[model samples]
Structure formats: C-alpha cells, structure tokens
Target chain A: MHKIWAVVRREFVERVRTKWFWVSAILGPVLFAGIIVFQIVQSMGGAVRNVAVVDSTTDKLGPKVIEALDASGSFRATLAAAGPGVIDSLSNLVESKQLNGFLIITDDLVQTGRAEYQASNLGMQTIESLQRTLGKLVVKARLEQRGVNPGVVDWAQIRIALDQKKISHGKAVSDSATQSFFMAYFMAILLFMAILLYGVNVMSSVLEEKTTRIIEVLVSSIRPFQLMLGKILGAGSVSFFQFVIWGVSARVLLSLRGPIARALGADPASVQTMVLPHIPAATLAVFIAFFLGGFLLYSAMFAAVGAMSSNEQEARQAQQPVTYLLMVSYLSILGLTNDPSSTFARTLSLVPFTTPIATPVRWTAGSMPTWELAASLVILAIGIVAVTWVYRVGILMTGKRPTVKELVRWVRTA
Target chain B: MPEPVVVDRVTKRFSGHTAVENGAGKTTTLRMIMDIYEPDAGSIRLFDQVGGGRIHSARIGYLPEERGLYPRMRVLDVLVFLAEAKGVSRRAARVKALEWLERLGLADWRLRKVSDLSKGMQQKVQFISTILHDPDLVILDEPFSGLDPVNSQVLRDTVVDYRHRGKTVLFSTHIMEHAEKLCDRLCIIARGKKLIDGTLAEVKHTHGGKHVIVEFDGTQGNARQIFADRQLVAKLQDFGQQAELELATGADAQEILKALVNSGARLARFELASPSLHKIFVDLVGPEAATAAASGARGANGGANA
Candidate 1:
C-alpha cells in the first residue's frame, strides 16, 4: 500500500509540475466562457442591410413595402425609380456597396406570391427574416383592400410559443426541453473528454516508464498492478482537479449572466430568467458514477495496451482497438440525444463499452429507467474488474507485440 | 545464512523458447528472486526467507540489466522516491539520497532533471537509487553496461565496498572480466540451464588444463602443419604470426614447447597460459554455444556442464 502511494505521489507531483497541466486547466474554462459570451452577443443583433424595392403592381405598393421593411429595424429599404434604368442603378448600388440587395415585386405577386431578392451574400437567417417581413406586409395590404378592419386584424393576430415541462410522479420537474437537452449534452461531452484525455495520459505514462526501463526497477519493490493502479488514480486526480475548476468557473460565469447583460444594455431580468437547468440530485449522482466507472474501465484497457508494446509508436498502433471503442461510444451520443428512450438507445446504454457516456445522457434527458441504470452500472463494474485484472497480469509482460490470440490466452490464464 | 540466493532447478520459458543465457533469463532469474515472478516448478530462496512468505523490499536492492530513471524527474527526487518505495521514511531517505549524491560526485546535479545530465551521471543516479535503502543483498544484472571507464571503476569500487561491509552481492554480466574480477562464486547459465557453478579456481580446475599461446618466427604453412599434426594440440587457432593451442587433458605445455623448438621453429614467444574465466566459459559451454550466445541466437540449449 505504501508502495502504491509512492507511485501515485510520484506520478501526481511529476505531472502537476509540468506547465501543460496549468495551461489546460486555465484555458478550458476561459474558452468555454468566451464561446457563451460570443453566442449572447450574436443573439442581440446583426449588421443592418440596405435594399431597394421594385414594385410593378397597379396598387403602387412600393412605399408600403419600404415602410414595412424600415419598421423591422434590420433593413433600410427605398423605392426604386420607374424604368429599366431602375434595375441598373440598383445593381450599381450593390456593386458600390451602398445596397446589400434588391427585391423585385412583380405585378402578379398577389396571384403568384413569388418575389426575388438578390444579394452578393446573404445568411439563411437574414433571408428568412426578409421573406417573413414581405409575407406579412402583402397579406396586410390585401386584407385592407378587401375592406377588412385593420384594428380587428391586428387584435386577431396571435404569438404562440410552447412552454415545455417535464414531470415525474405527477410533480413538474423544473427543466425546459432546451435546458435538459443542453445539460445532457454537456455532461456527456465533459465525461467523454475527461475519460479520453486522462485515459491516454495514463497509458502514455505507462509507456514512458516502460520504454525508459523504470518499470523494471519499480516492479522489483512493488507489484506491477500496484504501479498501474497508482498511475491511473494519479492521472484521474489531476483530471478531477481540472474538472472542478471548470465546474466552479462555469457556475460563477452563469451567475454573472444578469450583470453581463446589463453591461450590454439589456434587461437583467430576462437574462436571469434564462437560468441553467436544475439538475436533480439523482442525475448528478449518475453522472459522477458513470464518469469514475467509465474512466477506470477504459484506463485499465489502455494500460494493458501500453504494457504490451515496447515503445510509443508500437503503443499507438496497439491502442487502435481501444481508441475505436471509445470513438464508437462517443459517436453513439447522436443516437442517444435524438431519442434517449428509444430501445436502441437503451440497448446502447446497457452495453458496458458505451454505457459510461450513453447512460448518463439518458439519465439527464429524463428518460433512463432506474432498473436499467442499475443493470448498466453492474455491468460496468464487472468490466472494470475484468480489465484491471488484465492490466495486473499484462504489465509484467515485455518484448514484442502479442497477437490477439495470445492476448486472449493471457486473459484466460491470468 | 542459508546462502543469500539459491536457485534449484529453476526454469522459465517465454513463447515456448529458451531465453536464459543471453540476457532474457538473467533478468527473469533476478525478478524471480525479487518475487516478481513465481517459478513454475523450482524453488528460490532469498536471504533465508521461506518460499510462501513475503520478503521485505528494503532488504533487497536490484539493479536491472535494462536500467532507467525518470528523465523528467530530479535526481534527488528520483532517488528519494525509490528509497521511500522500499519503506524508508521520507526524511531519512532524503538524507541518505543526499549522502549518496555527494559520494557519487553528483551533489551539484541533485536538482537537475535526469535528462539534462550526461548518460554516465544518469547511470550513477540509477546506481544510487538501487542502494539507497541499504539492502542486505544487492543484485545487479549487467551493471557496467553503458558506463564510461571512470564510472565503471566507481561501480567496481562500490561493489567491492558493499562486499567489505558484509553484504551479499550477486550480479550477472556477459563480459567475463567483471565476473572474473569481482565475483567470489560465479554461476554460468546457458539456454535456461546452469552449466557450471563454483568459485573461480574450482570452475577452472573442473573444466581441465589451461590453454597455451605460442608465437614464433616461422612459415605460416609449416606452423599450421606442425600444430595440426600434434596430438597434444586439441584445438589450434592461427592468427598470422601467433598460434593459440588448447592442450589436451594431461598434456604437458613443456613437452609441446620442446617439440615446437625441435621442429626448426625460431621461437619469439612461448608461455604457459593462466586460465581465464572466458576460456573456462568457452570450455564449459563449448565454443559454438559461446559464439551463438555472442551473436544473440535464440532457443539453443546444448549440453550442460553440470
């Protein structure tokens, strides 16, 4: 036990002293916060567009179209002068960068309901907004011409947006659909990144020791399994340390959203109302459980891969199967997020290889059944036990890459 | 004291082939003594300890043939950590490590990363780590490898010092000179089997008479014919002006020298050979086995000497 602690302490102290550790720790949260800030600013507004309207209708609706576009506050519209020269002038305006685009409203727009808006470059969202503005103005003009009361039409318009609520045991859960989805995605990604980064770290450290021949000196005083476990736990601790910093930073940044919005000349209450999901205690527990269990399970396999190879190049090639396993689990997130309650998702969640990420995703999405979660955890525990046993025996092996048959034989004999 | 280390009919095979004589089994044997690998059939006893019980790691220091220290780690930290791993208290280990560093002339480099040090200095640090816990028995496999002459002499003195302090030391080396100069009792292994085991004198005596070297001013063809025709010369190697002859059992070197003179050979040099460990190794394991072992041929288990 003391030997194990010595190994652990050595690994942790040696790695923590490296500049990479501190750099990544600080950069992870800062980058995450930067992305959130950029998103908020993007949602606030975009650059206004200048456009020309060519109305060929008998009703002379060019002024009305310009008025409607101007009221949207995103477009500066002007009525084109009559004649073929109008198009040439508008094209020249676009070439001179004075106008972004020109919209051509044909005389048959009421019958055909089709118009062309041409621009040098346009984002889909901007184009959609322009289409909706013109659509509403055309309908309003037609209604006014047909003798409909403008006040009655305005009163009849509705703004309907669904309020999504999740319930458990006849009590409403305090999570919106968007919040739940993002929360599940965030947890899955966090766990995935942590496991892969740290698992590879453990494997390469083992490889480093092996190639440098320190492992021979180490195994003399301690069991190879103890060395392996010490390294895994040591790297795990570093990852956990970084994760806590990011978590705290995230919480602090989220709490400051109201102040951030007020600084940006927006209402604080509206920003405050967009609070992060209230993740239940059970969900958080599941997240922690899967994170640890999955990390241990995969790290053991990676350590075995490291032990079988004599150098880093060989280890990288030997690590392919394990890397592929991790990639498959990560990619299953797409299927999982699409429909967490689907039988396919449940099956994936039950598989030991994929369970770590898949199960937590389903749990946070409010779709994972309790028995299924328990069963998946049980399977994952068994996998951890089996992989660790392999690691213990495999680390003693040196020289040459073992064939798959030989590897399986070792597992059986061990 | 029950002989610090004893191997009785120990056998190990990796990938169904013998890996003993040429480094692979040397490491395996030492690891077995360290309890890293349990023998399949034979028993190994270390420091009089019983087989099924644990040996205190502090009482054993091993320098493996394939040696390495953490290159990114400081020399002092590496030594202290290894000492602490063997159950030494941190403070005591630190002091002992400092003393070792000073003794090895590496005190000035104590804080430098191992990779920043020269290979010889790094080797000394590795050596220091092995003995830091002050084990009763020190096992070193190929300890002189990758060492310059100065550091090699230092290691030789250190080993001699350990023996003077009443510690049992067992080391393996392919270079016969190290074993010849240092070991009081030596064991020669070939292809996973012990070929011969005894004191240096005893091993030479049991193997038989010494080999003789004779240099003379003579025609090369004539010298070859003279040696080839003689019954006393069991094996003869002609190197231009010199010829080395292995005398047959019970054959007298004086008789051969007289015969060479009578054959009209102008003698430049003639001497009765002192038996060397290399000659003994070649005689015991056979010249073919020695050559194969030298060339690193795998899975060759020829005849055993004992």
Candidate 2:
C-alpha cells in the first residue's frame, strides 16, 4: 500500500506541476464559462438592428405605422430617398452602407402575405429592425380593417394582466413560467460540462504522460488502475475544489455575480431561476455514485490506452476511438435529457461505459428508475474491478503490442 | 561463506536463436556466487545461504546490456527509487544518491533529467542506481561500453570502492583491458560459449612459451632462413622489417639468438613483456572473436555518451 501510494503521490505531484495540467485543471472552467458568456452576449447583442423602408405597394402603410414601430425605441429606421440608391432596393442601401438595411414593400404586398427574410450573419441587425417595423404596419392594417381605431387598439394593448396562480399542491401564487425550463437546462448543462471537463482532463493527462515515457517508471511502482484511479480522483479533487470555489464564489459573489458574469462574458440570466426544486436526496446520492463510478471506470480504460501507447502523440490517437464513443453517450444523453424515458437514452444509461455520463444526466432529468440506476451502478462496480485487473496486469507487458486476437486469448486465460 | 555465485551448466534460448546456448565451451563458471542464467539442467546458489533466482536477484544487482532506465525520469529520482526499493530508507537513498553524484563528480547535475545527460553520464547514473542498493554481488553486462577515460575511471573507482567494501563484483565486457584491470575472475563467452575462465596470470601460464623478439637488421631479409628449423622457430615476424617472433613452448631463447647471430643478422634489441589480455582473448576466443571485441570500453576520457 505504501508503494502504491508512493507511486500515486509521485504521479499526483508530477502531473500537478506540469504546465499542461495547471492550464487545463485551473484554467479550463474559466475558459468554459468565458465561452458561454461570450455566446450569450453575441446572441443577444445581434438580435437588434437599424433599417429603412419604402413602399411600392398600391396601398401604402400609414405614417403612424412608422411612428408606432419607432415608438418601441429598439432601433433607428431611417426613411430613405426616392433615388438610385433609394429604399426601393434593399441591396443598394445595404451595399452602399448608407443604411444598415431596408425592407421593400413590393407592389403585391397587401394582396399577397408572403414576406421574404434575408440577412447577412454579419448584418443580422437588419433582421430585427425589419421585423419590428413591418410588425407595426401589419398591426395597423389589421386594426383599420377591423374598423377599430388604431388608438383604441394601441390603448387596449397597453396592458391587461392575467394573474397566474402558482398552484403548488394547493396554494395560489404567481411565478415566472419559463423559469423551470431555464433551471432544468442549467442543471443539465452544469452536469454535462462538469463531466466533460474532467473526462477530457483525464484523457489529456494520460496522453501527456504516455507521450513522455514517464508512465513507464510510474507503472513499475503501482498498478495502472491505481495510477488511473489516483489521477482521476486527484484531478477530480482539484476540479472539484475549483468547482467548490465557484459555488462559494457564486454565493459570496452574489452581488458581484452580474459583474463577474459580464467579465467572464457569461450571462446570469441564462441560469437564473434554473435551480431544480427539491431534488430527492436519493437521486442526488445516485448521481454522486454514478459520477465517481463513471469517472473511475472510464478513466481506467483511458489510462490503459496511455499505457499501450509509446508516447503522448500515439496515446492521443488511441484515445479518439474511445472519446468518440463517449461523445455518442453525451449526444444520446442530450436526447435523453429532452425526454428521459426515450428508448435510446434509457437503454444507453445501463451500459457501464456510457452509464457514468448518461445515468447522471437521466437522473437529473428525473428519468432513471431506482432499480435500473442501482443495476447500472452495480454493473459499473463490476466493470471497475474487472477493468482494474486487466489494466494492472496488462500495463507491464513490455514491447509487445497485443493484437485483438491476442488480447482475447489473454483475457480468456486470465 | 559459500561462493557468491554458482552456475552448473546454464543455457538460454530465444524463439529460434540461442543467446547463452549452453555451458559448453565455457571458460570458468562461478560455483559460489549467484549465477545469472538459471541452469536449465543444474542448479545455482547465491550468497552461500540462499538458492534460486528470487534470492539472488534481490541481493545481487544487475545492469543488463539493454537500456532500462526511464528516459525522462530525473537521475537522482530513479537512483533513489531503486535504493528504497532495495529496502533503504528514503533518507538514506537521498543521501547515498547525492554522495554518488558528487563522488562521480556529477554533483552539479543531481537534478538534471536523465535523458538530458550524455549517454555516458546517463550510463553512470544507471551505474549509480544499480549499486546504490549495496548488493553483495553485481553482474554488469558490458558495463564499460560508452564512456570516456575520465568518467570510465569514475565508474572504475566506484567498482573499486565496492570491492574495497568487500563486495564481489562480476561484470562481462568485450573490452579486454577493463576485464584485465578490474576483474578477479571471468567467464568469456564466444558465439554463446565460454572460452576461458581464470585469474589473468593462471590463463597466461597455461599459454606457455618464453616469447622471443627477433628485430633483424632491416636488410636481414629471409629471416626465417636464419632460424629455419620450424620446430625451433615458433612464429616469424614480417612487419616491413620489424617482425615479432615467439619461440615454441619451452624453447631456449639462446638457440634463436645463436641462430640469428650465426646467420650474421645484427639484433637491434631484445626484451620480454607479459602477454596482454587482448592477446589471450584472441588466442582463446579465436582471432575472429577477438576482432569482434570493441576497443572503447573505458570512457577513459570521462565521456558517458561515447
């Protein structure tokens, strides 16, 4: 045991000291959150734009329509001139950059309800401006056609409140409707990114050592399973520690969450109201089990690949086939999270390799049955032992590359 | 104490090739110490008390011809690991490692990566690692392959120290000089067969004959005619006017001198030097096997990555 620990501690220290690890183990989450916020900002910021419109229709939109559309104060719509670069041709205005964009109400507009939608991804702002402006014209036309004054329609829409009862069991109160979906998605994504980050971390760490020939010395002292276990736990602990800081940081920085999120380029609104309500303690217990079992079970196999490869580069190559399998699990879980009872997701959840990632996802989605989850965990336990035995024995075989037939024979004899 | 190693007829074979084929053609086999190849047809006892491989391998250190050290591992770390594995306390391992590094004049390089070290330095580090466990017996297969004079001496000194400390060291080297200088006894294997075994002098004694040198005056052509009796003339020299001649075993040197002088050949010089290890190796293992011997065994210049 001391020898095993000596091996483990040495591996732990060696890995933790490396530049690649500190970069990934410490910086990976920061980058992940950064990317998320960046995406949100990019998405929301691109949703609005400025545009101008000119009508060649027989029946033109009223002046009030433009004012009504402009009244929202979301974007600026410049009414264009009637010349060569006029508002009649959207292509010209956009090409000249004189206007951000324009909408042409062609001669058949009122008679035909068809509206074409086009916008450069770089010019996505044009989409919203056209929508808002044209939305006003349609509303105005409908009101006038219904013989209701536009003022009455506008005044009537000024607001009527439907007080929704937040009926929990028996109580009557109101809460936001979209909050549950947002909360579920947040929980699901958190479980996802956490698993992925650590799993790849396991892979990359194995790759680095495999490439460096350090694994050879390491395997001499401890079994490969122990090495893999120690690394998975050690790295997981490091990641877990960081995540704890993130959790505490979230609470301690509650006031600063907004600023931090913005700085990180993530959005607070995305995960807001996204908390699961009253997770059964048992389900959470299973999730923790599945998480550990999954990391160990899969990470051991990863360590095996590391052992088989002569260097880090080859190990990375060997890891891809397994990683792609993990990816399938992740994708299937994504489908499962949508409907946990779906045949595909539930079936994969039982497989030992995919179970680790998929089971927890289904649990979070509240789709896993208690017996099935127990069975998966049991299968995972067996896999851990069996794989550990193989990894431990196989790691020390020098210079001989075992082929599939050879591996099968060895396994049977073993 | 029983002999440190004893091997009674050992043999080893690979798939189709035999590495240490058999005990046949053997020089001298260790009877008391640990024998490396477990006898396929006999037995080996190590340290006088223990028998079998597990006992010997544990007590006896070995440096295989194959490179076995972790390439990227720190030199000190690998040494210390081996030391501790040999049952030394971690502290002792550290202290011993540093002492070895300094004694080997590698003190400044205690922390350098093993792979970064020159091949000679790396070999030295491996040497240090092999002996740090303080095994009573060590079997170094070609220990002095890639080394310059100075580093070779450092290793040579370390081996001497091990001997001074009463450790019995046995190493195989194709460098006859290293064996001549360091070995107390040897079992030279040629074509996977031992050719000779004994103390240097013992074997040289068996190689009887009072050697004679006939440095005839450069003009003394047809020198064989001067000592034309094939029975009296053991060999003739023909080295572009400087030929060496060894008289037949137990032949009188005076007879050759008389013959050459009677032939009116003026002698330039005369002297006798004991047979060198190289000559003995060639004679016993055959001239072909002698040529197979590598010249640079000692990093006499203190190089490790020779």
List TM-scores for all candidates, in order.
0.82, 0.64
Instruction: Name the regions of candidate 2 deviating beyond 4 angstroms.
Output: A22-255, A259-320, A334-355, A358-403, A406-414, B2-93, B110-124, B132-139, B192-285, B290-306
Model 2, A24-116: lDDT tens digits are 544655665665555556545343455565655446552443565577555455554335655347676567665555555654444455455
For the candidates in turn, chain A alone yields TM-scores of 0.84, 0.69
- What does the lDDT read for residue A200 in candidate 1? 83
Q: In candidate 1, what are the lDDT values of residues B1-306, reduced to their tens digit?
A: 245666666666666765543223676777777776766657876655665113567887888888888889998999989887788888999999999999889999999999999988888898888889888777787777788999899888887777777776778777787777787677777656667667776767787566887887664334566677556778766677877788877778887777777767777888787667777677677777773221111110111101
What is the C-alpha interface RMSD of model 1?
A: 2.2
Query: What is the lDDT, from 0 to 100, of the residue A325 in candidate 1?
Result: 84
For candidate 1, write residues A1-414 as lDDT tens digits: 887888888888987899988898889788977876775565454446888888887888788889988998788888886677888888888998888899888766666678888887787877888888878876777788788898866665656767777774356776676776677678767767877777788888888878887877777677777888898898888888878888899888887877777787665654434545577887789888998888888888888888888888998888888888888888887788789899989888888888988898887677766898899999998887777767666666777777878867777877
- The segments of candidate 1 whose C-alpha lies over 4 angstroms from its true place after superposition are A16-109, A116-121, A137-177, A244-274, A393-399, B18-25, B50-55, B199-275, B291-306
lDDT of 2 by residue, B57-156 (tens): 4365666554456565677877876565444567888998999899877888888777788877877787787777677766665666666777677778
